[model samples]
Target: MAALSGLAVTGGTIAACTGKAKPQVQGKLLGPSFKAGHLLRKGINVVPTETEEQEVVIVGGGASGLAAARWLKKHSDKNILLLELENETGGNSAAGKNEQTAYPWGAHYLPLPNNSFTELLDFLQETNVITGYDAKGLPIYNEYYLCFDPEERLYINNYWQEGLVPRWGVPENDLQQIERFQQLTEELKQAKGIDGKYAFDIPVDHSSADAQYRDLDQLTMLEWLQQHELTSEYLHWYVDYACRDDFGSALAHTSAWAGIHYFASRKAEASNSEPHRILTWPEGNNWLVQRLRESCTDRIRTNAMVYRVGEQDGKVAVDYMDLRTQKYKRILAEQCIMATPQFVNQRLLSALPELLSTRNLQSFEYVPWLVANLTLKDVPHGKGLSLCWDNVIYGSKSLGYVYANHQQVALFPEKKTITFYHALADEAPAAARGKAYGSSYEDWKAVVLQELEKAHPGIQEQVEQLDVWVWGHGMIYPKPGFIWSEDRQQAGAPYQNKLYFAHTDLSGISVFEEAFYRGITAARQLLNTERA
Candidate 1:
């Protein structure tokens, strides 16, 4: 196989190898291949047959799988099958709609893309989100998608304040510490390792492996902050909010490397706005997912839960159960891309030949989240900052909420809707999920209303309808050593140059950038094999 050297593969002559259709073989017995057969025998029934062929079978129809499918279709003429467990393709980026407006269920926001994120930028351009470039060659993002004015407000000391960082009624010393921290992060953004990799980069894999920087992965963010004498309660709260907002983990639970990366990894230079600006739609990331879905709608199969995967007779076979039909179907493919999370993939590939032990794969943990969308007659305004795109409360366990109607600049008269997103920061995700699931709709509504009532008393009266969603395993939490661990690195590597893994889990931190990069990486690997 030819070595894959570039980010994009434009065109290729790849074709599926033709073969006669084989009858469905059902049994628990191992196939001809001893290793693969033995591995299948240990797992649940429904192993792959040796005599079947498919061009490619992609598991999970999330951003990663969709990205891979887009790349495969654009680059080569190969038969590809994309399987998704849900009825939708967006995964956590899924959206919900009411009579008033559409809202996000899980992931609701995305930061602006850095210039180094060429693939992402190109995709945005293709989608018309990047309308054109300025004279200086920076991207001028679409005005409609760029987050509107009055971006964020935080409720603190019984007053709503402008911006996320605590500025109102804060001690001068703590303010100085916050300034120092931002300045240091700015320096780190420009810093480069001896190996020429950025000290901090999106997708994280692009970061420099230099020991000077990699050593940071060994310590917790809390430890690093304390070591730097940044012990102010306000400063700590802000940092913890940022961590939970993106990584779904608190400062003490996150790695110093991941924490600093959140601040320094952003190097986005745009023609219209500063590097810190972000692009968002009313429905959040669902807008981007719609663009991805446009690439290969015909090939995607939703509600197709993949159960088993294995290689047999130099080909890969994926056995899946159709949730709607309750029928089992097997897809024979030359290659397979597992874009599901590590935990789900572990179940599917448990039957695969020479697969890793389950114990090793179980080391990773995911955090849960509760997102509530409320239709309101009006949002009670406080004295200081007005309702904005992001509304947060200072010193609160919850990450406040976002107003979905904010992007619809055209003002409405009677009613407005706001989605309150709560990241369960303190408790274990499993416990939180259990609590959330056991609770009724009214109970969940009470939970959300109570949290809101803390900041806005009697605000529940303005609410017309409240809907709640619980993501049991919302995102992978980057514990101290997870990102730089050898185990995670090995798990992400392709198996036998045919089975590739792509997911936010592989990146050890779940973000849109990581999911996009994961898909591109897996697609590039498969393209290389075809070229070879």
Candidate 2:
């Protein structure tokens, strides 16, 4: 990424889903810096005309990069610089704003954290997410941050249901199966392994190392359900939705351990909220990114892409370009953190593949995703429930939409905006990405209208503006054998005691907590090595 290499440019604007005299929908197709990413394949031959030195340098301005910078500044007096390819730094946790409200571009919400993750809890407290602790030592979360009432609703049985679990029109047998499955997951949430560790943990690495659980990583989530005889169509649909929602893969494609972790990994509790309660804002996790950024804004450099990272003169040499000015610069750091994805890392560190000798870069599989934020005059009420924070269609291709203003304290809004999500997981990653990149506004607008038209018959006419963002490689999913694989561990290991790696992919799951920890992990490693 040279200058604004991956800035979300308006691909095009069109009169969307309109005919005759209908007030035409407006907005442009904006997406990740896939163009800049594409340029990486062409190769780099850079001789920097400018050079600088830093005690530590961070490459990539995503959650991990920002977090690492935030932590390093708190603990070290060393010079540090964070290079980001895009005009903005949040990465998937990024956000945007319109007159109506703020909405998420990628990751939207963070569930209640496991209380035992004290570092995360501390960050939350520092950010005012956790107000204080209760008498029992449980966190007293800010009530405003906890999702307001009517938290989730499912459009099923031609009506809206109170919660996501299938109940309304499901057959009695299916309902029984759903209840049984819930019980099983709840049990798994508490179940530990022979090694005396929780069967599933949020970060995945801290989970039980016992082979019984590790073997589960080898099977597809579908295989696990089949073995358990939980064959209810509704149950499978719910499970698949969870897999796609969190892991961005289908039931058969997602590893069983990862799928189970979707349900079992969440054990967060708060005195003011229910177990697994979520904390959200109008801007989604971008609010968290803002909090993380607050501690280290001065250290971040936007529109700066590190094209090459190698060792030079006993230090890590990072060659980057300022996309805005077409100027090249180099930063020689005593230590560095590579927070970019392996897809990019494989190219930047190509000269020293030995640094990643133990890792199979090709083994990592990232899925493409579509997020559309539509500002509408109003959302039509389905049969049973009104607009809720999180909404989903029972058996739809899209993940439904979230009312972006759901967390707002405003009793009545002049307009409503909903952020819709879709994972292109019906096909292989290559095919899905091809479709997403090739599709235009007309192609995408039709898909959004089709999904929404069923629930709200005339939603197309209510549209004021429609903005689309495409994630070419949304998040790394845990495929069969990928999570527990040796490569995952090796991928995160330090190189030459001078370079360290930090990214959600290294953990094989792209939750906010994981990314936050990935940053801290790398920062601590760098700090500990320096102490040595």
Best TM-score goes to which candidate?
A: 2
TM-score of each: 0.89, 0.95
lDDT (tens digit, per residue) of candidate 2 on 197-235 = 999987778899989888999999999999999999999
Q: What's model 1's lDDT at 360?
A: 60
Clashing pairs in 1: 1-532, 2-532, 54-332, 54-333
**Model 2: how large is the Cα RMSD against the reference?**
4.3
* Lowest lDDT block of 10, candidate 2: 1-10
Native-structure RMSD, model 1 = 13.8
For model 1, residues 1-532, the per-residue Cα lDDT tens digits are 1111111111121111112322221111110122322343355575434333568988988888888888888888988889887778988888887776788877777788988888999999999989988888888898888888889888888888888999899989999999988898899998999999999998789999988898998999999999999998999999999899888888888899999998999988888776777888778898888888888898888877676887556778788766688677787788899998886766677666366752367778888777778777789978787788999988777788989988886787367878777666566656654554455554455556667867886675577777777676788978898888887888788888889988988988888988989998999999897788
Which ten contiguous residues of candidate 1 have the minimum total lDDT? 1-10
Given candidate 2, what's the lDDT at residue 430?
73
> What lDDT score goes with residue 295 in model 2?
86
Compared to the true structure, candidate 2 yields what TM-score? 0.95
